[model samples]
Target: MNRKGAHLEGVFLDFPDLIGAYLNGTHLERTYFRWANLSNVDLANADLADANLEGTDLIGAKNLTIDQLSKVKTLYNAKLDPEREIALREKYPALFEKPDE
Candidate 1:
């Protein structure tokens, strides 16, 4: 399937309809999904850095963050408002890591 700009993290899930395209394993690397609905899906190893998921409906997607659910981020309507970035950055300070600090 031509995902326009959907990042198929390798696994093109073949299941029920109500959801967006399936992406289980495709070596996803910083892909953009402007408003894609990814509810209830496994996206481990998917590099979502700098990916613009504005207004994306991830109401049930699993593992958008890293490692375990504990690292979960930007899923199930993850407030993408421009103003939210400030708060998010404040909440997760480690995000601003120096490359060679």
Candidate 2:
């Protein structure tokens, strides 16, 4: 699934298995990813602003920086590398907030 630079705003992806997908530079603003498996996905330069990532599996995701996660609406229950999760939580506590309606 190569969707580099694609505009996917406001899309709803429930439990989608997108492992190893290439989503670099994609526009994922306001997207809903509930319990989705995005492990090993390339998210370099992807715009995840206001995206809902509750219960989303991002473990081992490639090019996934804390800066990108900072812009997301929420990361509650999102699976990430232990160290990365700690760093993100310490740097951006608001991203762990409850999802917005």
Give one digit per residue, the lDDT tens place, for model 1 in 2-84: 23335444333222232644454434443445456566555545455444444455555544443322233232334333434
> What ranges in model 1 sit over 4 Å off?
1-22, 66-101
lDDT to native, each model: 0.43, 0.94
lDDT of 2 by residue, 28-91 (tens): 9999999999999999999999889999999999999988998888999899999889999899
Model 2 error, position 25 (Å)? 0.8
| Model 2 TM-score, all chains together | 0.94
| TM per prediction | 0.44, 0.94
By lDDT, the best candidate is 2
- Clash pairs, candidate 1, are 9-25, 9-26, 10-25, 10-26, 11-24, 11-25, 11-26, 40-60, 40-61, 58-76
What global local distance difference test value does model 1 have?
Answer: 0.43
Model 1: what TM-score? 0.44
